[model samples]
Target: MKHIFKNGIIGLACLFSFNAMAENYTIGTGSQSGTYYPLGGILAKIWSENIEDFDMRAEVTAASVENTIKVSSNKQLAGIAMGNVVLQAHEGIKPFPRKMDVSVLFALYPNVVQFIVPADSDIKSIKDLKGKRISLGAPGSGTRVSATNILASLGITDKDIDAQSLNYTATTNAISAGQIDAGVIVGSVGVGAITELAFTHKIRILSFTADELKKVSEDNASYQSIEVPAESYKNVSAFNAPAVWNILIVNKNMDTDLAYQMTKVAFENMSKINQVISVTKFTTLENMNKLNGIDLHPGSLKYLKEQM
Candidate 1:
C-alpha cells in the first residue's frame, strides 16, 4: 500500500509538470475599434478550439508599431502588422524604437487608405487638405505613418495641415462633431467605424489618381496598387484604390512546434475565412509566395515546403 501511494504521487507530479510546460500564447492585435482586433479575436478562438495543448488570446495594442515591439520582447507569440511597417520595424526605421525580432507567418491582406471628409467640406482632393484640420490616425500607428508618407508625397507636410493624431474612434467622433475636416484611416473596406459613420453623415473618399498612385508606389517599395470596389461604403462610390499590405508576424523565439501549428491553422482555414470576410479573398497561396524581404519562421517555412 505504501509503494502504490508513492507511485501515485510521482505520477501526479509528472502530469502537473507536463501541464505547466504547455504554452498559452497571446497574439498582439490592433485597436479594439479596428478590424485587426476582431480578426485577431476570431483567430484566437479558432486556434484555441482547433489546436491541441495550445491556448491563444488576442491583446489590444496601439496597432502595428506596438505589436512589433511586443512580439520582439516575447510578450506576444504572434502579431498583425502592416506590411510596410513590418519592413521598417525590422530595419529599425523612424517609427520603430529599435530593431525587432519580427518574422513573417504570412501576408494577411491589404489595408487600403481611406480618407473620409464631410460632403460639404472643401477638401475635394489630397492637395486641398492644406490648412485644414485632419486626423492622421492614432500616434504610433501604421495608419499615421502611411498618412504622413502620402501627405509628404503630395507636398502637404505637418506645417501645411492641422494634424490631429487620433484613433479611429476619436477621429470618427471628431469628424461627426465637425471638429475636424477630414480623417485618414488605413483599414479594409467595410470597416465598422467607417460604416457606422456613413449611416449618419455624408462623407466622401478622396482617391489617388493614377499618376499619384504611380508616384506613391515608386516612393515606397512596400506599397502596392489596390482597388476598393464601389459600394464598399454607403456614401462612397467605387474607385480604384491604392494601398499597402498588412502582414502577420511571429516572434523569432517562439517554440517551433507552436509556430508550425499556428501557420498550418491559418492556411488550412484560409478558404473558410475568405468566405466570411471578403478582404480575405485576396489571401492566396500565390500571394504568400510573393511576400519578400522578410524571413519566414523556420516552422512556417517547413509548412510551406510541405505545401510546395
Candidate 2:
C-alpha cells in the first residue's frame, strides 16, 4: 500500500510538471461569425496537437487592424490580418500610429472586396452608392479600410455617402431589412455572412471595371484583380473584384524555433485545415510569397528556404 501511494504521488507530480510546462498563447481572430474566428480555432488546435507543451486559444477581436496592432504590441502572439493593413502597420501609415515589428507567417487566403446591394435597387454601380447609406464593416476591421480606399479611388469618399460601421452579420442584417442601400464585406469567397444573406434576399455584387481595378492597383499594389467564380453565391454571377491576401502575422520577437515549428505544422496540415474551412485551399506555399511588402518571419523564412 505504501509503495502504491508513493507511485501515485510520483505520477501526480509528473502530471503537474507537464501542465506547468505547457505554454498557452492566443491567436487574435475577427468576430465570432467571421472566417478568421473558426480558422483561428483550427490553427490553435493544430498547433496544440502537434507541438509539445504548447496551447493556443482563439480570441474574438475587431479583425485586421486590431489584430495587427495587438500582435505587433505583443498583446497576442499572432493574428490573421489583411495584407494591406499589415503593410500600413509596417510602414507606420495612417490608422497605425507607429511602425510595428510584424512578420508574416504565411498567406492564408484572398479576401475579395464584395459590395452587396439589394437586387431591386436602382444602384447599378458603386457610383450609385453616392449619398446612400452604406456599411463599411466594423471600425477596426480591414473591410473598412479596403472599402474606403477602393471607394476613394473611384471618387466616392466618406462625405459622398452615409458611412456606417457594422460587422459582417449586422451589415447583412441591415441590408436584408432594407435599412442600408449597400455594404462592403472583405472575406474569402463564400463568406458565411454574405452566403446567409444571399439565401433570403435577392442581391447584386458590384464588379470592378478594368479601369477601376487599374486605378486601385496603381494606388495600392496590395489589391489584386480577381474573378469571383460563378455560383459562388446563390444566383450571383461571377464578377471581377479587387482582393487582398489575408496573412498570418506574428510579433517579430517570437522565438525562432516556435515560429519555425508553427509554420512547418501549418503547411503540413493544410489538408486538415481545409477540412475545417474550405477557403484554406488558397493557403499554399505558392501564395505565401504573394504578400511582398511585409517581411517574412525569420523562422518561416528558414522553413521556406528549406523547401527551395
Candidate 3:
C-alpha cells in the first residue's frame, strides 16, 4: 500500500510539470472587422489544435503600426504586419512612433494597392485621381500610408485630391453610393471587402503606368510592382498595379524555443489553416525564405533550416 501511494504521487508530479511547461502565446492581429483579424484567429486555432505544449491565441489591434508597437513593447508575443510597415518599423520611419525591437517570423503575402472607381466615373488612369474625391483607406492603416506615399511619389499631394480616411467597408460603400470618386484598398487580392464590393457594384481597377511605377519605387523602396490579373475582381479587366509585401513578426525578446515552435506549427499546419481563411493561401515555404532586411528570430531560422 505504501509503495502504491508513493508511485501515484510521483506520477501526479510529472503530470503537473508537463502541464506547467506548456507555452501560451498571443498573436497581435489587425482590426476586428478586417482580414488580418480572421486570418490571425484561424492561425491561432491551427497552432493551438496541432502543436503540442504550446497554446496560441489572437488579439485584435489597430493594424500594422499598432501591431508593431505592441510587439516592440512586449505586449504581444507575435504579430501580423504589412511587410512595408515591418521594414519601416525596423528602420524607425514614418508610421512607427519610434525605433522598435521587432523581428520577422516570415513573409505572409502581398498587400496589393487596389484603386476602385465607380463604373460611371470618368477617372481612367492613376493621374485622373487629381482633384477627385477618394478614400485613402483608414487612418493608422497600412493602406493609408501606402496610398499617401504612392501619390506623393507621383507629385500628387493631399492638396491635389479630396482624400478621405475610411476603412475598406466604408470606402466600398462610399464608392457605391457615389460619395467618393475612387477608393484605395491595400489588402490581399480577393479580400472579402473587395469581393463584396464587386458583387454589388460595377467597378474598374486603375492601372499604374511605367513612369508612375518608377516614381513610386524610387520614393518608397518597399513598394513592389505587381500585376493584379484581370478577373481577380468583378467587372474588372487585367492590369498591373504596385503593391507592398506583408509579414508576420514577433517581439524581439520572445522565447527562442517557443517562437520556433510557433513558426514551425504555422508552416506545418498551413493547409489546415487555409481551409479556415483563404487569405492564408499566400502563406508558403518559398515566400518565407524571401524575407530580407528584417532580422529573423534565431528560433525561426532554426525551424526553417530544419525544414530545408
Which candidate's lDDT is highest?
Answer: 2
lDDT of 3 by residue, 1-308 (tens): 01011213222112224436655667888665567888888878877786665567898776787788877776666788887788888889877767788888887888888899987789999989999999998887788888888888888999999999988888888998889999998888887788888899899989999888888888788778888778888878887788877888877765576568778888878888778777677777767845567767777888888877
lDDT for each residue of candidate 1 in 1-308, tens digit (9 for 90 to 100): 01011213222122224445434678888788788897888788778777765568999887888888877766676788888888888888888777777888777888888899987888777788899999999887899988898788767899999999999999999999999999998998788889989999888888778888887888787878877777788858776656777888877655566667878897888776666566877766666644567787777878888888
Arranged by TM-score, best first? 2, 1, 3
lDDT value for model 1: 0.79
Q: Tell me the spans in candidate 1 whose CA falls farther than 4 Å from its real position.
A: 1-22
Q: Model 3: runs farther than 4 Å from truth?
A: 1-25, 52-54
Candidate 3 residue 232 Cα shift, in angstroms, is 1.1
Clashing pairs in 2: none
The TM-score obtained by model 1 is: 0.90
Question: Taking the tens digit of each residue's C-alpha lDDT, what string does model 2 give over 1-308?
Answer: 01011213222122325436666689999988779999999999999999777779999999999999988777787899999999999999979999987889888899999999998989888779899999999999999999999999999999999999999999999999989999999998899998998899889899888998999999989998999887899988888999999999988766677778999999998899999999999888777767987778888988999987
Q: What is the Cα-based lDDT of residue 235 in candidate 1?
A: 59
